[model samples]
Target: MDLQTFMKDRKKLVEDALFSYMNAVKAPEVLLESMNYSLKAGGKRLRPLLVLATLKSFGKSEELGMPVACAVEMIHTYSLVHDDLPSMDDDDFRRGKPTNHKVFGEAMAILAGDALLTHSFEVMEDLLNYDVKPIKVVTLMKELAKAAGPTGMVGGQVADMEGEGAQLSLQDLEYIHRNKTGKLLGYSIVAGAILGDATEEQISKLEQFADHLGLAFQIRDDILDIEGDAAKIGKPVGSDTLNEKVTYPSLLTMNGAKEKLEYHIKEAKRILEEIPLESDLLGQLCDLIAKRDH
Candidate 1:
């Protein structure tokens, strides 16, 4: 199948599974509504797609990886919900609609985000039912925790908040994006590799690929903020500047940022070439990340 067709089919599968999983959660009606609100809010299901794509690259069944894929997406959605809270980005819209806190109120929005985060682990436990080894499942769970916890996304977020409106070195900026945006992304690929029974060497190479891909992803995001249309990107352009957040373009200059984006894309694809698996899908994904407008 072509890359576009492959992504469309797998994206639908991920969306269906997300809806089913959210429907199974028993909670107060309003809380569930709040959770489902952001969960259903439209965005590229890139993280989960990465999981299934990595599995497919290794000739594993996508169904076997679905649980992990959904779990990772849940964690991602939860982060967005919290990130839009009054205490954080304070954004009023997401995916072309009111943000969770705006529609559900801040207290319920916070609870909903908490619910998604905790429930992701519960969803991951379902992996045991798929005949996956308990040890592998345990490892994935531990990795997911670390990726989403203090030393990863949360730490990056704290650093990003602290660095706002200040002059930050490129190294420091890279550190913030790698952990804040890259750790969970890296986890998605690594989880698939583990489930697909990748050799240790292949897993290591894929991790390196994911790291570069993650930075490329963030660079594209920064570029979009400058040149993207709100109708397509589903938010106001220039919000980063308005918020006093330092972006790649702001620090490196627009031309320099684009150059860095291309570098990361090339590096990610180069690492993919070194892996033994049929990694064309992953390579195509790297290009997509580099060029995605939203």
Candidate 2:
């Protein structure tokens, strides 16, 4: 199981579960179509992959974590759907296709995103059907809510919107991304650790690992905005500059940003080394995030 093969296998598994879960939802044809449209739109299923990968690292069955993995992905997709609306980032494309609002209209797109967000909890509750302990499921539900809610992604989004056209410090930029992007990513790993029955100490270390990994992920994204190919990234390059948002490269030059990315990758992998588990895949994932074109 090499890293690429492992990722391909897990991505397929997550995709199958996503469609299966979406098919089970009973809604108006238009709304359901809108929801499934974005849900099926192609992207690296990184958040869900993290869940399954963490479970595997702890010697747990990936099947047991499948529902949680899918649920997190749903939340992630919902956020993207909303993020593309006219009131938000106002992007016309995602994953190399017209965004949800573009294809479905703004009203339906909003409803579709709402459906995914609420439905994610229902999907997460399905973990009990796999005989996951009620307590663990309940705990995960709480954590997921916090991660996706105001204190997490939503809070980060609001801060980002407010910071637009304004000069932002690196600390402020970190605050925005740490909550906006990092919280959900951190949740992906933490969910697996909980279900995999990690010790408190190990969970703490993994959280630290997730923190560094999340920052590295965002920094690379900023780098890609300037240097990456639009075709591979699935969006126009220089969106950050076009939107007038401050980025790592803007705050600390391109070279400085790359150095910062390297620092976080080293720290993330260092934290992984201290955790007693089969974490080679996670280390590879860190490298992938650093070098990913999309």
TM-score of each: 0.98, 0.98
Please provide, for model 1 over 1-294, each residue's C-alpha lDDT reduced to its tens digit, 9 standing for 90 to 100. 467788888999999998898888888999999988898895788899889999999999989888899999989999999998888988898887899999989999999999999999999988999999999999999999999999999999999989988899999999999999999999999999999999999999999999999999999999999999888888889988888888999999999999999999999989899988865789888888898877
Q: Model 1: number of clashes?
A: 0
Candidate 2 segments whose C-alpha is farther than 4 A from its true place: none
Clashing pairs counted in every model? 0, 0
Judged by whole-model lDDT over C-alpha atoms, candidate 1 comes out at 0.91
Which consecutive 10 residues in model 1 have the weakest lDDT in total?
1-10
| TM-score of model 2 vs. true structure | 0.98
Clashing residue pairs found in predicted model 1: none
